[model samples]
Target: MRRTTDRTAPPTPPPRADIDQRTAERLPVTLPVTYTIHDPAGPIEGTTVTSNLSGTGVGFRIQQPVAPASPCRLRLTLPQRTDPLHFTGRVAWCRKIPHDSPQTFEVQVGLALSTPADVREEPSFATYCHFVASELVKRYLG
Candidate 1:
């Protein structure tokens, strides 16, 4: 008889939300989200909506679990903006919920603001950041 062991990792401890570690406040802003993730299983792509938005990061729901620290591409459609913003971001976090689709159920993903797009994308992501920052300054100062 042979013994088998599954490659399981220790679960990451949940963050202390009470601490309010966020640098920028997240707003309940819903925008369009089309994301693509490349994993060992394959490439996963889906159209979803953002759960929240912030200057430093974005929270959106997708169909698959995107590995943390992986580079994921996203196209965000801002309201009243005719052009969709395309950018690549590092997967900051994700949480999955049990759904009808086996273990690969719905998962919410968080993406950190990464570097400007160099290829296969545009630089609108950085522009969006600037727009948000300016808005904040205006609201508080102006």
Candidate 2:
């Protein structure tokens, strides 16, 4: 059997909410982060790796879809830090990767972290953010 493609087929239009919008600069780094989804009934916990990191939010992948505006607790494990950095964040958006097969697609979640009472006081968190931002600048702009 032979399959033929239509040369005149139109390309699929991109989604309206493009994830490329960067309010804050982000670095492409992979870090393991344990997250607990905050639900009224109970909490659902899972492990995932961060796709990118920035001062405001992080993008990570998950096997299942998480609702937008869901509060979550993240414990990020960075190579420079001995102890995982703990923080609270709110789900800003959720999108599934466009794949030919729906079953193989992974859900990407963007979380906007709630500012700590004293960001200056949290040296480790501040250091980690600086590290990521520096790396991003070094790679792209430096």
Candidate 3:
């Protein structure tokens, strides 16, 4: 009698290229942030927390859906600086977050900044971004 063997191939890997499309790296952070949506008539302001931060953008959760491409202003205090950093950006995208509760349906918004312009306009912003990226890299990637 001849011996028989069964062989199984390994599973396919995830698509890393699609995931790494972002030009700037993102750091997972939970920090309190206040945001203002610019409107033609008047500006609407609200308080929320940042989910992540990068040189080019930020992510946050909100109670309501924000229209894509809407202009926004963000304010948050980083550990390196005593004063808060202000950023001007636009709503890149928004998606509904599923929850167990019926009364609450939170939305996650991706806010992307108009790079180069912001950093060049504000010297402090450039410094703050550098500090954040360096610190995050040292702590996690170093």
RMSD to the hidden true structure, all candidates:
8.2, 9.2, 12.0
Error of 2 at 118 (Å): 3.0
- Model 3 has a clash total of 0
Order by lDDT, highest first: 2, 3, 1
Clash pairs of candidate 3? none
Q: Per-residue lDDT for 21-94 in model 3, tens only?
A: 44567678776789987645457678878898777788888777666677998888777567787778887767
Q: What digit string (tens of lDDT, one per residue) describes model 1 on residues 60-135?
A: 8776666677677888888788788886777777777668867566777778766544522535856687666665
- Candidate 3 minimal-lDDT segment of 10 residues: 1-10
Taking the tens digit of each residue's C-alpha lDDT, what string does model 2 give over 77-119? Answer: 8876678888888877776765697568777777888876787
Q: How many residue pairs clash in each candidate?
A: 0, 0, 0
Q: Which regions of candidate 1 are displaced past 4 Å? A: 1-21, 99-105, 117-123, 134-142
Candidate 2, residue 55: Cα displacement in angstroms equals: 1.1
Model 1 error, position 25 (Å): 1.6
- Measured by lDDT, the strongest candidate is 2
* Candidate number with the higher TM-score (1 or 3): 3
